[model samples]
Target: MDDVRLSLREWLILKDIESALRRGRRIGGLLRTPRRSIWLPTAVGLLVAASGFLMVAGIRTSDPAVIWAFAAVWPFALLQAFRLLCRWTTPHGISVKASR
Candidate 1:
Protein backbone atom coordinates (compact mmCIF):
# COMPACT_ATOMS: atom_id res chain seq x y z
CA MET A 1 0.00 0.00 0.00
CA ASP A 2 2.95 2.30 0.72
CA ASP A 3 4.00 2.01 -2.91
CA VAL A 4 0.57 2.85 -4.33
CA ARG A 5 0.75 6.64 -4.40
CA LEU A 6 -0.51 8.35 -7.57
CA SER A 7 1.92 10.52 -9.48
CA LEU A 8 1.14 14.21 -10.24
CA ARG A 9 -0.01 13.42 -13.78
CA GLU A 10 -2.21 10.62 -12.60
CA TRP A 11 -3.78 12.92 -10.00
CA LEU A 12 -4.38 15.57 -12.64
CA ILE A 13 -6.02 13.06 -14.97
CA LEU A 14 -8.28 11.80 -12.20
CA LYS A 15 -9.27 15.33 -11.36
CA ASP A 16 -10.07 16.01 -14.99
CA ILE A 17 -12.30 12.94 -15.17
CA GLU A 18 -14.17 13.95 -12.04
CA SER A 19 -14.71 17.46 -13.38
CA ALA A 20 -16.00 16.05 -16.65
CA LEU A 21 -18.48 13.88 -14.80
CA ARG A 22 -19.79 16.87 -12.88
CA ARG A 23 -20.22 18.87 -16.06
CA GLY A 24 -21.96 15.98 -17.78
CA ARG A 25 -24.40 15.65 -14.91
CA ARG A 26 -25.22 19.35 -15.04
CA ILE A 27 -25.77 19.22 -18.79
CA GLY A 28 -27.90 16.09 -18.52
CA GLY A 29 -30.10 17.77 -15.94
CA LEU A 30 -30.52 20.83 -18.13
CA LEU A 31 -31.38 18.76 -21.19
CA ARG A 32 -33.81 16.50 -19.38
CA THR A 33 -35.92 19.30 -17.90
CA PRO A 34 -39.29 19.15 -19.65
CA ARG A 35 -41.59 22.08 -20.34
CA ARG A 36 -44.09 20.51 -17.97
CA SER A 37 -41.45 20.68 -15.25
CA ILE A 38 -42.22 24.37 -15.12
CA TRP A 39 -45.16 23.36 -12.96
CA LEU A 40 -42.87 22.60 -10.00
CA PRO A 41 -41.62 26.15 -9.69
CA THR A 42 -45.08 27.51 -10.38
CA ALA A 43 -46.46 25.34 -7.60
CA VAL A 44 -43.76 26.48 -5.26
CA GLY A 45 -44.55 30.08 -6.19
CA LEU A 46 -48.19 29.46 -5.35
CA LEU A 47 -47.28 28.02 -1.98
CA VAL A 48 -45.14 31.08 -1.29
CA ALA A 49 -47.91 33.37 -2.39
CA ALA A 50 -50.42 31.58 -0.21
CA SER A 51 -48.04 31.81 2.70
CA GLY A 52 -47.75 35.54 2.15
CA PHE A 53 -51.49 35.89 2.05
CA LEU A 54 -51.85 33.93 5.26
CA MET A 55 -49.37 36.20 6.97
CA VAL A 56 -51.03 39.36 5.66
CA ALA A 57 -54.45 38.20 6.77
CA GLY A 58 -53.22 37.89 10.37
CA ILE A 59 -54.22 34.28 10.52
CA ARG A 60 -53.74 32.52 13.85
CA THR A 61 -50.74 30.15 14.22
CA SER A 62 -48.95 31.90 11.40
CA ASP A 63 -45.65 30.84 12.93
CA PRO A 64 -46.16 27.25 11.84
CA ALA A 65 -47.39 28.44 8.48
CA VAL A 66 -44.28 30.54 8.02
CA ILE A 67 -42.08 27.61 9.00
CA TRP A 68 -43.78 25.49 6.37
CA ALA A 69 -43.12 28.23 3.86
CA PHE A 70 -39.42 28.14 4.75
CA ALA A 71 -39.46 24.38 4.27
CA ALA A 72 -40.98 24.79 0.83
CA VAL A 73 -38.25 27.26 -0.10
CA TRP A 74 -35.42 25.13 1.28
CA PRO A 75 -34.97 22.87 -1.73
CA PHE A 76 -34.22 25.79 -4.03
CA ALA A 77 -31.83 27.18 -1.45
CA LEU A 78 -29.99 23.87 -1.24
CA LEU A 79 -29.85 23.54 -5.03
CA GLN A 80 -28.28 26.98 -5.29
CA ALA A 81 -25.75 26.10 -2.59
CA PHE A 82 -24.76 22.88 -4.33
CA ARG A 83 -24.40 24.71 -7.63
CA LEU A 84 -22.20 27.30 -5.95
CA LEU A 85 -20.00 24.67 -4.33
CA CYS A 86 -19.64 22.70 -7.55
CA ARG A 87 -18.72 25.89 -9.38
CA TRP A 88 -16.14 26.70 -6.72
CA THR A 89 -14.32 23.33 -6.59
CA THR A 90 -14.36 22.50 -10.30
CA PRO A 91 -11.48 23.56 -12.54
CA HIS A 92 -12.02 26.73 -14.55
CA GLY A 93 -11.92 27.31 -18.36
CA ILE A 94 -12.97 23.73 -18.93
CA SER A 95 -16.71 23.45 -18.33
CA VAL A 96 -18.14 26.36 -16.38
CA LYS A 97 -16.97 29.87 -15.67
CA ALA A 98 -15.68 30.90 -12.24
CA SER A 99 -18.21 32.54 -9.92
CA ARG A 100 -17.42 36.18 -9.36
Candidate 2:
Protein backbone atom coordinates (compact mmCIF):
# COMPACT_ATOMS: atom_id res chain seq x y z
CA MET A 1 0.00 0.00 0.00
CA ASP A 2 1.17 3.56 -0.70
CA ASP A 3 1.74 5.65 2.44
CA VAL A 4 -1.61 5.52 4.22
CA ARG A 5 -2.81 8.21 6.58
CA LEU A 6 -6.09 8.94 8.39
CA SER A 7 -7.21 12.55 8.68
CA LEU A 8 -8.37 13.69 12.18
CA ARG A 9 -12.06 13.18 11.33
CA GLU A 10 -11.49 9.72 9.87
CA TRP A 11 -9.30 8.73 12.82
CA LEU A 12 -12.05 9.71 15.28
CA ILE A 13 -14.61 7.73 13.31
CA LEU A 14 -12.36 4.69 13.28
CA LYS A 15 -11.82 4.97 17.02
CA ASP A 16 -15.59 5.05 17.57
CA ILE A 17 -16.06 2.00 15.38
CA GLU A 18 -13.40 0.11 17.33
CA SER A 19 -15.09 0.99 20.62
CA ALA A 20 -18.46 -0.18 19.32
CA LEU A 21 -17.01 -3.50 18.17
CA ARG A 22 -15.40 -3.98 21.59
CA ARG A 23 -18.77 -3.50 23.29
CA GLY A 24 -20.60 -5.77 20.87
CA ARG A 25 -19.11 -8.94 22.30
CA ARG A 26 -20.46 -8.11 25.75
CA ILE A 27 -23.88 -7.36 24.32
CA GLY A 28 -23.84 -10.67 22.47
CA GLY A 29 -23.02 -12.61 25.64
CA LEU A 30 -25.79 -10.92 27.62
CA LEU A 31 -28.26 -11.78 24.88
CA ARG A 32 -27.28 -15.42 25.33
CA THR A 33 -28.06 -15.36 29.07
CA PRO A 34 -31.22 -17.18 30.19
CA ARG A 35 -32.54 -14.25 32.24
CA ARG A 36 -33.10 -12.25 29.08
CA SER A 37 -35.73 -14.77 27.92
CA ILE A 38 -38.87 -14.90 30.05
CA TRP A 39 -40.91 -17.60 28.36
CA LEU A 40 -39.09 -20.71 29.55
CA PRO A 41 -39.05 -19.64 33.17
CA THR A 42 -42.68 -18.62 32.97
CA ALA A 43 -43.61 -22.02 31.60
CA VAL A 44 -41.63 -23.82 34.29
CA GLY A 45 -43.24 -21.76 37.03
CA LEU A 46 -46.68 -22.54 35.59
CA LEU A 47 -45.89 -26.23 35.57
CA VAL A 48 -44.81 -26.15 39.22
CA ALA A 49 -47.90 -24.18 40.18
CA ALA A 50 -50.16 -26.57 38.30
CA SER A 51 -48.53 -29.50 40.06
CA GLY A 52 -49.28 -27.90 43.44
CA PHE A 53 -52.91 -27.46 42.43
CA LEU A 54 -53.10 -31.07 41.36
CA MET A 55 -51.69 -32.30 44.66
CA VAL A 56 -54.19 -30.18 46.55
CA ALA A 57 -57.06 -31.50 44.51
CA GLY A 58 -55.89 -35.06 45.06
CA ILE A 59 -55.77 -34.63 48.83
CA ARG A 60 -59.10 -32.84 49.05
CA THR A 61 -60.98 -35.40 46.99
CA SER A 62 -58.90 -38.51 47.81
CA ASP A 63 -58.43 -39.16 44.07
CA PRO A 64 -55.68 -41.57 43.15
CA ALA A 65 -55.48 -40.47 39.53
CA VAL A 66 -54.93 -36.81 40.39
CA ILE A 67 -52.24 -37.78 42.88
CA TRP A 68 -50.58 -39.97 40.29
CA ALA A 69 -50.66 -37.15 37.77
CA PHE A 70 -49.05 -34.83 40.24
CA ALA A 71 -46.38 -37.41 40.96
CA ALA A 72 -45.68 -37.89 37.29
CA VAL A 73 -45.24 -34.17 36.64
CA TRP A 74 -43.59 -32.99 39.86
CA PRO A 75 -40.09 -34.32 39.24
CA PHE A 76 -39.56 -32.64 35.90
CA ALA A 77 -41.17 -29.40 37.03
CA LEU A 78 -39.08 -29.24 40.17
CA LEU A 79 -35.89 -30.02 38.31
CA GLN A 80 -36.52 -27.24 35.83
CA ALA A 81 -37.29 -24.91 38.71
CA PHE A 82 -34.02 -25.82 40.38
CA ARG A 83 -32.01 -25.36 37.22
CA LEU A 84 -33.69 -22.03 36.47
CA LEU A 85 -33.08 -20.89 40.02
CA CYS A 86 -29.41 -21.76 39.79
CA ARG A 87 -29.00 -19.98 36.50
CA TRP A 88 -30.82 -16.83 37.61
CA THR A 89 -29.09 -16.70 40.95
CA THR A 90 -25.61 -16.81 39.44
CA PRO A 91 -24.04 -13.37 39.12
CA HIS A 92 -23.95 -12.18 35.55
CA GLY A 93 -20.32 -11.20 35.89
CA ILE A 94 -19.39 -14.73 36.90
CA SER A 95 -21.68 -16.39 34.40
CA VAL A 96 -20.47 -14.27 31.50
CA LYS A 97 -16.89 -13.81 32.69
CA ALA A 98 -17.25 -10.08 32.27
CA SER A 99 -14.39 -7.87 33.40
CA ARG A 100 -16.55 -4.88 34.21
Candidate 3:
Protein backbone atom coordinates (compact mmCIF):
# COMPACT_ATOMS: atom_id res chain seq x y z
CA MET A 1 0.00 0.00 0.00
CA ASP A 2 1.01 3.69 -0.44
CA ASP A 3 1.04 4.18 3.33
CA VAL A 4 3.67 1.44 3.76
CA ARG A 5 5.83 3.01 1.05
CA LEU A 6 5.64 6.49 2.70
CA SER A 7 6.47 5.03 6.13
CA LEU A 8 9.46 3.19 4.67
CA ARG A 9 10.72 6.37 3.03
CA GLU A 10 10.40 8.31 6.29
CA TRP A 11 12.22 5.55 8.18
CA LEU A 12 15.04 5.56 5.62
CA ILE A 13 15.39 9.33 5.87
CA LEU A 14 15.60 9.13 9.66
CA LYS A 15 18.15 6.34 9.42
CA ASP A 16 20.27 8.45 7.03
CA ILE A 17 20.15 11.34 9.46
CA GLU A 18 21.20 9.06 12.32
CA SER A 19 24.10 7.74 10.26
CA ALA A 20 25.21 11.26 9.43
CA LEU A 21 25.13 12.23 13.13
CA ARG A 22 27.13 9.14 14.06
CA ARG A 23 29.69 10.09 11.42
CA GLY A 24 30.03 13.55 13.09
CA ARG A 25 28.51 15.35 10.13
CA ARG A 26 26.49 18.46 10.83
CA ILE A 27 22.93 18.89 9.55
CA GLY A 28 23.78 22.53 8.86
CA GLY A 29 26.41 21.43 6.35
CA LEU A 30 23.94 19.07 4.66
CA LEU A 31 21.42 21.86 4.26
CA ARG A 32 23.21 25.00 3.11
CA THR A 33 21.66 28.22 4.46
CA PRO A 34 22.12 31.77 3.22
CA ARG A 35 21.72 33.44 6.64
CA ARG A 36 24.55 35.35 8.33
CA SER A 37 25.14 34.25 11.95
CA ILE A 38 28.53 35.46 13.15
CA TRP A 39 28.26 38.87 14.83
CA LEU A 40 26.59 37.92 18.12
CA PRO A 41 29.17 35.26 18.94
CA THR A 42 31.97 37.59 17.98
CA ALA A 43 30.55 40.26 20.28
CA VAL A 44 30.21 37.77 23.12
CA GLY A 45 33.77 36.58 22.63
CA LEU A 46 35.06 40.13 22.69
CA LEU A 47 33.07 40.96 25.80
CA VAL A 48 34.38 37.94 27.70
CA ALA A 49 37.91 38.65 26.56
CA ALA A 50 37.64 42.27 27.64
CA SER A 51 36.16 41.30 30.99
CA GLY A 52 39.05 38.87 31.64
CA PHE A 53 41.63 41.43 30.64
CA LEU A 54 40.03 44.07 32.84
CA MET A 55 39.93 41.66 35.79
CA VAL A 56 43.62 40.89 35.46
CA ALA A 57 44.57 44.51 34.94
CA GLY A 58 42.53 45.63 37.93
CA ILE A 59 44.22 43.04 40.12
CA ARG A 60 47.76 43.85 39.01
CA THR A 61 47.61 47.66 38.80
CA SER A 62 48.43 49.67 41.93
CA ASP A 63 46.32 52.75 41.02
CA PRO A 64 43.00 52.88 42.91
CA ALA A 65 41.20 54.80 40.15
CA VAL A 66 42.26 52.30 37.48
CA ILE A 67 41.26 49.36 39.67
CA TRP A 68 37.88 50.87 40.56
CA ALA A 69 37.02 51.74 36.95
CA PHE A 70 37.91 48.27 35.64
CA ALA A 71 36.04 46.68 38.53
CA ALA A 72 32.89 48.59 37.57
CA VAL A 73 33.11 47.77 33.84
CA TRP A 74 34.15 44.08 34.00
CA PRO A 75 30.94 42.74 35.55
CA PHE A 76 28.80 44.67 33.06
CA ALA A 77 30.76 43.18 30.15
CA LEU A 78 30.37 39.65 31.54
CA LEU A 79 26.62 40.18 32.10
CA GLN A 80 26.20 41.52 28.57
CA ALA A 81 28.02 38.50 27.21
CA PHE A 82 25.74 36.15 29.15
CA ARG A 83 22.63 38.02 27.96
CA LEU A 84 23.78 37.88 24.33
CA LEU A 85 24.50 34.13 24.63
CA CYS A 86 21.02 33.48 26.08
CA ARG A 87 19.34 35.60 23.41
CA TRP A 88 21.22 33.86 20.63
CA THR A 89 20.39 30.35 21.89
CA THR A 90 16.69 30.84 22.74
CA PRO A 91 14.20 29.53 20.15
CA HIS A 92 12.40 32.27 18.21
CA GLY A 93 8.82 30.94 18.47
CA ILE A 94 8.77 30.15 22.21
CA SER A 95 7.62 32.83 24.66
CA VAL A 96 8.72 32.46 28.26
CA LYS A 97 6.25 33.52 30.97
CA ALA A 98 7.29 34.42 34.48
CA SER A 99 5.74 32.24 37.18
CA ARG A 100 3.81 34.16 39.81
| Candidate that scores best on lDDT | 2
Model 2: per-residue lDDT, tens digit, 1-100? 6989999999999988766765796565554444457876998989989999998999999889998999999998988898788877877754535485
Which RMSD does model 2 reach against the true structure? 9.1
CA displacement after TM-score superposition, residue 73 of candidate 3 (Å) = 1.9
What lDDT would candidate 2 get against the real structure?
Answer: 0.81
Compared with the true structure, all predictions reach lDDT values of 0.59, 0.81, 0.68
Q: Give the Cα-based TM-score of candidate 3 against the true structure.
A: 0.45
> TM-score per candidate, in order?
0.33, 0.57, 0.45
Winning model by TM-score = 2
lDDT of 3: 0.68
Worst 10 residues of 1 by lDDT: 28-37
Q: Which scores greater on TM-score, model 1 or model 2?
A: 2
